[model samples]
Target: MELELVRLPNGVRIALDPMPGLATAALGVWQRVGARWEPAELNGVAHLFEHMAFKGAGARDARQFAEAIENAGANMNAATGYERTAYYARTVAEQAPFALDLIADILFEPHWAPDDLEKEKGVVAQERGEAFDAPDDRVFEQHQSALYKDQPLGRPILGTEAALKNVSVDTLINFRAMHMTPERVVVSIAGAFDRDAIIDTATRRFGGLKARPDPEREAARPQTGHASETRKLEQTHLVFSWPSPPAGSDQLYAARMLSEIFGGGMSSRLFQEVRETRGLVYAIDSATDTLEDDGRLSVYAGCSAQHAHEVAEVVRGQLELMAAKGPTEAELKRAKAVTRSSMLMGLEAPSARAEARVSQLFLRDKLTDFAELRARMDAVTCGQVQAIAAKALEGPACAAAIGPKAGHGALEAFGAK
Candidate 1:
């Protein structure tokens, strides 16, 4: 990977990954702000800001923004996450200028009209409804809320209807002014491209923006335990979350390795034991989330209400066994292969590569190339994996469940609410 990092005079960090021979490239404008950066009263503004950005910018209306990008043979989208919000596009390398211009316009010259704001609130209301329409998705929100309580991080990214109604045009404008500074953002591009040409285009487009101080984000310390929402559903959905290390910690990768071995695929321990052998669940998996200051190792399962407790028991047993005995050499090797293969396969896509590079710049303040990352992955001993499992699962576990009212008793017996 040919890589270059340039800090423009305006404080924007620009990273270029010029992959040779590929015809297309991906670029992203990543702001070092998201739900985590919002205050209590402003819970959903970051996500609301994302929706409004697409409504219009400078000389372009919403339709013009969409039409221009389509005309340029590209697609553009944005997402708001716990620690970062990003806007991205992937297209022929020659379309970099057009893509960057549209992105820059939205970020730097957004138009937050009153009509658009009210219309957007309704749009987000519908979006939030769709998200909650799925029991599993709704349960995860409750689970996440139970983990990181009384903070911006715990709230849903799409703020509640009450919060959305409270957001005004001035709020979005002020948010853009405060958090979306050049210094707190990164512009990254990857795939077949001329590094200097792209850099010049970025400078010309994003050069004049002034830098603002990055907000002081309150750290997220999870308040663990149980929370359950009673709902009428055929399959009970449950999530168990335990504390883990932060994004930049050395233990972060170990937690990931441990998580994958525990429940990553059909071959994983949870899948085989809980799903294949006993047939307790249709879907069961474990994953980890690493935020700027904290993280979670969680398991999710969708099971028949009558047997949800059995699924949790099996899940608990797998964690206990791994924490006590650690993964076997075979398990470790297979997990490494699975993780490494997944990484390599994802890097084949320009969009994935661009997002990874930009994320590294935004989060780590630097990027770890594949070889170095692989070396670290290879160096994680089985003992280290076991140790991480023990430490991560040692804390109080937070669980949230959505199912028939009758199954609440079963969940309580399993130490869930």
Candidate 2:
């Protein structure tokens, strides 16, 4: 695998990864700005802008845009996240240029039809409602608020109904001009594409934009407390979060190792103990959610209201045990195996590979070799993992729950009032 990189005179970065013998390709334009960069008044304008981009751009209406891609046998989509917004496409290698053109059109030549903003706002309202109605999703949203408190990071990416109502075409246009500059954008393509043509097209399309100062963003301020919502559901959804190393930290590999051993899989501690052994919960898992400036070690479980307290206690016990003594040698070996296999498996897919490239460029400002990643994971010792776990437990944990019990005893178990 070889990666070709180009930095245009205007500060736009283009990365091309050539995968020989593959028939398809995946490519995208990823910007370093997302919900966190949005002003409070425009909280969800980024997401709304993404949805509207497809409605019309260049000389095509929404129908024309859809037909263009379908006619070319290409797929196009976009996503907005906490720290980034991506416009991406996947298609046969032969259609890579057309796919790229479609993406470019949606991005550079957006045509916000007069009625589109209102309709999109209504659509997003439905989206926000659906998310609010799902107990599990609602729990995570509450957990996020607790984790970041009053910070932008705490706010839901799906802008509130009030914020969405405030959005207009001018709002979207202003937000784009502020954050979607050349300096914050990366154009990446992977798979069996004509590298020269792709790079040339990218340069011609993206190079004209003038460079500007990087967008301002608030540093993540992780708070530790409890957030809860009561609802009459069959089972309680509980989430526990602890502060952890941010992205690009040396301790990240160790932190991930700890998560894998703690609850990443069926053979892991939380699953085996909380579910298979004690049968306290039907589902329990742990994951490390890392962003550029902050992260959290989170554990989630679904169980009967009656067993919520017991489940929380068990989870706390397991976390403390992991932090105190680390994983057994067997557990460590298994974690390494799981992590290594997952990395390898992801590398086999063009879309996954493209996403990884974008993430690496954002985090490390360069593509990290696979061998280097594997080496780092292999070098994470039990002591390192233990240190990461113990350090996270030393701080206050954020807890969220939504259900019949409203996390009555669960939050108390984690010492979150």
Candidate 3:
């Protein structure tokens, strides 16, 4: 993949990925600041800011902005996550400039009306309620809270109702002014496009803005504990987390290998032992969540409340076994194949390529081409995977469960240091 990068005088970084033989392009503006960067009082301001972006920006009202993008045959949306907030649009290659301009206007010329602000808060409150209403979402939120504890990282991305009430037009404007500065922003586009024209447009739209000093970010430290909420559900939803390598760590590839072997698919240990053999769970899987400075390896399962304890034990046992004996040569080979195949398949889509560029820029402060990313995955040995698995057992585990109380104690028991 040939990725082009250009930096404006104001420190706005632009990355362009030219995918040959494609007629459409995917593009986004990514800000490094997210839910984790919010102050205690402004817990969900980052997300609120994302929603407010579409309410009105530049000369376009909400309806006008929607119409403009649709008139151009483009789909534009935005998302807020724990580590970053992204505004993205997909369009035919010829309209890439228009998409970028709209995103730039969202960033630099947002207008949050008083009525809009109040209405958005109500919308976000509903969003929050819908999220917690799902058992899986509730369990993961509990798991994050258990792991991150009293920090902003632990808080829900949808600010609490009380906190949502505190958000005003000034809140969105100040957040944009402070965290959406040139240095903290990255504009990336991928797929067939006029590279020179896109770069010229970016220089015109994002240039001239002054850079600001990056705000202080609180370093994340995972805490160990267990939390649970009882609900009238037939199945218990459980989540388990252990400390893992950070996004920029050398051990990151190894952690990925460990997750794949542990519970990545039907062939993985958790699925085979906990689901196929024992029928302890309807589903079980493990994955890694890595942030700039820290990360966690999480395992999740849904099962009868009576089997929750057994499922948790079996999951822990699989990790211990992997740590003790390491993965077989066949397991290692399969993991590498799965990891590489997934990456290669994803490259066919412009959106995937755009996301990869944004992720590398924010996580590592530089572009790591696909070759290097695959090489890192390929270089991980069985011993390295084992070491990462062993390291997971060294920390206090974080656990969360939703459903009946019968299974809740199992999480507490398993989570105890």
Q: Write down the TM-score of every candidate.
A: 0.97, 0.98, 0.98
Which residues of candidate 2, in runs, are more than 4 Å off?
Answer: none
What lDDT does model 3 reach?
0.88
| Tens digits of per-residue lDDT for model 3, 278-378 | 98899889999999888889999999999998888888888889989999989999999999999998888899999888888777778778989899999
Deviation in Å, model 1, residue 1 alpha carbon: 8.1
Clashes of each: 0, 0, 0
Top-lDDT structure, candidate number: 3
Alpha carbon RMSD to native, model 3: 1.2
Clashes of 3: 0
Off by over 4 Å in 3: none
Look at candidate 3 and tell me the lDDT of residue 379: 94
Tens digits of per-residue lDDT for model 2, 217-292 = 9999887789888888999999998888998888899999999999999999999999999988888899999999
Query: Which residues of candidate 1, in runs, are more than 4 Å off?
Result: none
